[model samples]
Target: MAKNQVAPIKGMTLPQLELMAAVLGAHLGRHLLDELELERVVYWSDSQIVIHWLSSEKQQNKFIKNRRKEINDLTGSKHWRYVPTHSNPADLQTRGISAKEFEDNTLWFHGPPWITQPQSWPVWKECDTTVLSAIENTETENCSETAKDKRMEPTSNVMDIVQIERFNSYQKLLRVTAYVIRFVDNLRKREDRNQGKLTAGELQRAANMWIRDIQHNIYSTELECLRSRTQHHLIRQLKLYIDPGNMLRCGGRINNAPIPTDAKFPLLLPGKHKFTHLLIQDTHQRNCHAGTGTVVTLLRQRVWIPAARQIVRSVLRKCVSCKKVSGKPYLAPAPPPLPKDRMLDSEPFSVTGVDFTGELHVKSANGRDKKVYICLFTCANTRAVHLEIVPDLTEESFLRAFRRFISRKSLPKIMMSDNATTFVSAAENIRRLSQSVAVTDTLCQAGTVWKFIPKRAPWYGGYWERLTGITKDCIKKVLGCTYM
Candidate 1:
């Protein structure tokens, strides 16, 4: 005979002990007897109550029901044979026999006395189902225990078959979470009017329940201690409390203040909670991609998440809009080396800047009002101005003004102006004149070097424009409100 000893767990009753023995017998039968090709298997237990539990059709309590199911699953009820407490050798180990007495005990070393004689083996009895149900029901009258059983009851749609993918960005994730929360809030409002707004406390409760559902096995003891009203170190240190919503909240000094519902008791959350990223993202978007301080302020108005400034700063740092809007301006490159002409000492009229002024009204010899534009040329080094009036803005009219200015100031070596169409065309015409040897010699005598400023930058030729402004003021005073 092969014997195994198992000490009863503390606080376990005789029925629990009997169930444990049946499980051990099943293990032995599978490992030893089945390997030896034995056909018959019997489970012997001294506790009749355990036998009744296995045979009972109606399960009265959740604990007994679960254990009874396990016992039947491992061994058939027909295999269970009742044994008197005195005849069962397993009881010797249960009551514990002295080592000196156990050295000659046949019941402990071999099998029970009745096991040697097949005719003397205990018989199986049909338990009274009604009497067993009545007795067990009366013994298991615990309201809290029943409530636990209800909580453990498996729902039909408890498991979701589909897979969910994580959101791309933290902001996107929080936006999605906020949308889901809003939807759930709507559903709750439809069910009951009091559930109008989904508070942070309520959201925290949902988050906790979700966490417990997935991580119950790992955090069972901690969560149980938390729910048991024990003096949890965290609860005392953080001033945390579970509201009627069953959410962990930071119970600060805001209870008496005239604050909003969210700030009164913000949800206390773990550092690694998934909602932390989403909350930061949501707050950022809510404030219209605001700065760290604004985002933190807005978030505090609704949820009292910790590291508010840090988390908001982190999320905002990665925010595309915030980066585009508030990113540091690139340091302007060091000013380029000034042009040689502007820096070198030269003759007063040797370098000149030329530009156009508007069409002014001048009385024609035919007694008809005519439009004429002014061409202003200034000596860049000396800041002297020469203004000439032309009829139209064509190359010929501008050439006339240019020839008159050159005649008055002699010829300039370098002349700079904006890249106006007329100036470009006149420069091209002058270059074409240089192709001829006669015209080239004439231009070489003038030593005119035409330079065009960058397009649309009139500030580059401010000297000539300033002279033009003064000429305009003088003309305006002379004309006195005349359309010129």
Candidate 2:
């Protein structure tokens, strides 16, 4: 049997709700055992606080005492045991689930799997006394009349006047704070109220007011020690002193220098504060998005932020404009592993990459100019080159060049080339010729496989392409625009 109830709308603490749940479970269990004529029944609760309250002999308030008595009378302390919240099936009922989830859930129907095995049940451990004591203290205070009076007391702080973290820009915060101060002054004296644009003095006063509030909030103890003429280790080494306006300023050794007063004794600011971040951001923009070193130098001229360099670096790192202008491109991944043909150790030109270079003009014996092309065959492994000059790019012309190459070097088992029309046509012609009756049996048996790379990817056949470049360079140096 299972039962659940919604908590009262009047509001109740978590421990109070948990105790009420224990009472509900007790009522449900007692009715089930009475109606079914069961010999024994066990009760389980996820809240250790309720279990401790039921077992404890200590006196409790009327609210907890009454509920505890009802639960003990119905189920008895011996039947109560602790269960982990996650393993308790009632937890799902407290927090609703979708209809689909309710249909699929088995824990609600059968309880935790360990409920069938008595040895695996959760062992009872002592509840933390501190947690119980805190709950008791809270309950006691809530019942007292003085607590209600304390709650009615008004609390005020600087943040109640103006929230510093609400503004993104330091300049905007200063203007808004100045306006607030002006409005307050006008309320005090209706006549002769300052109106129109705010003067420079008002803005400066607002900035000082904000700075003083922030320092007092963060370093209240240190400020108190300084005011009482006592030493505090946190700011003792900085030689800090209060100015006439009651704002903390650094009293360094350079006070006697010819520089300005603000430069010699800059105002102290906490580096991790939100106002400090806004100040750094403002200075970064005013300097036309300068580097960290430049921003730090400019900021230190009037304000001394501890760990200024680190804070400036962090602030600059988040600037979108700087990121867009100075960010580096994504690095390319490493090159893939070399192909099997290129890694094989064999005779030079056994596996070759072939490509065509260019057309050259040479004088024939009849005093007529003829066009010639350079057919480059480079070793895939050794990078050896074998150049052959052909009259044209036709299959017959390239056949003769291929025959010359094989006759000079070892017969290439694999021929890799780009998918040029000349190479494709020559490969087709060689395939047809190899099956002809005129070809020798030895030549037919030792047939070479031609492999064409992907279309328009010259880098696939770079072995021969690079050799063609070198051959062109050599020709340029030797011929020097000569035809022959």
Candidate 3:
């Protein structure tokens, strides 16, 4: 049995492809042995490098090492042997041949002539050990150098108290950290075991402990200066001090103000720390997603984070509720270019756009007011217009107004209008009028085509619709509240 496949697009060395082929052959041999109940089997290949790799015991790269191990497990290394390229029958299949030649080829159908003779099998010499040992020593030196580099890496100075990153909410972190501290305290004093919902005092102690540890890790140099009575340039302007509980607090000009102590000297916190993120996030939620100014004002009551407004703004931006309430709407893509009818430079009124504008009241001959409508026609290319007054919105009235337009401006090849009911009825009437046998030859030969824009899209007929607006504005300005 034999199998073939195209090579991968990612280039690989020739030796790697050969070893992969050996792996495929080993699997095939194992399957054949189990199905046929054979006593023994052997694997053969044309590449000498693959034969040596199977027998070598030294370590190699991961790609070669893994495949070598699987090939050995399926077919023992001792059973694998080499065959000369000319004598190997598998080579004939890899190198192409004509169909007529392949049909009469005996080497492919039957093995090499020496295969039936037991004593004539090709002998595979063992690879030299001296060269292999040197290669192995070089690989060992490389691995040692990698380990030495890792050992000399620097360590982080920031001490995480209880894995603050694991908790999402600020309240949850405080509660969990408080429980851990209470558990440790109870271990020392077995006589007094305080067991119930955590009291306010216990939660307060947990918050203070967290703040103290964070300050110690990040502001160690500044704290050391304060203890030694020496001012550091970083905090010399802030007038920093250590309180009785060994916590860093800010000292301001309001030392004698008659107000709360927390407002006087709030706890100092680094703006970029993870704990500060959680604190700002919790304050934002507790205030019902208020504005940044409101959240910053509330946070300043107890903790003083440097660059507080900028940090609070970043945290608020990530809030899901705030995003839902204030996010901008998606922008629409640009409008398409104008259609062919509008772009062509044809004769005036060759392609005409029509629409209706009004309900102007006009006095009839009987001296009573009568309602009337205006029909406006615009040239698609020249933008010239023609107007006519009709008594009503019926198709008969519009057909008369249309006849008047064509008589003065000449017949138009294409007529475009909105999808109003009156326009639709008039288009059908015009089609029927053109098909009548009694009509004149000029009207029948013209074969005028009527087109309507898509329903509810007034912008599609803006060529004439804009004229309707201008005509109405002029009429409104000229005849304030009187009938014409």
Candidate lDDT (C-alpha), each: 0.66, 0.82, 0.81
Check candidate 2 and list the clashing pairs.
none
What lDDT score is found at residue 284 in candidate 2? 96
Q: For every model shown, what is its TM-score relative to the native structure?
A: 0.40, 0.47, 0.51
Per-model C-alpha RMSD: 26.7, 23.2, 25.2
| TM-score winner | 3
Q: For model 1, how does the per-residue alpha-carbon lDDT over 333-441 read when each residue is reduced to its tens digit?
A: 7866657777658766788888788768867887788888888877777787777878898999988888787787787888898999899898888778777888787
Q: Model 3: clashing residue pairs?
A: none
Instruction: Write one digit per residue (lDDT tens) for candidate 3, span 14-55.
Output: 878888888888888999999998899978898877877788
Q: Which ten residues in a row have the lowest lDDT in candidate 2?
A: 134-143
- Which is the better candidate, 1 or 3, if ranked by lDDT? 3
Residue 427 in candidate 3, Cα distance off native in Å? 2.4
TM-score of 1: 0.40
**Poorly placed runs, candidate 3 (over 4 Å):** 1-161, 209-274, 291-293, 303-318, 321-330, 349-352, 356-401, 404-410, 437-447, 456-484
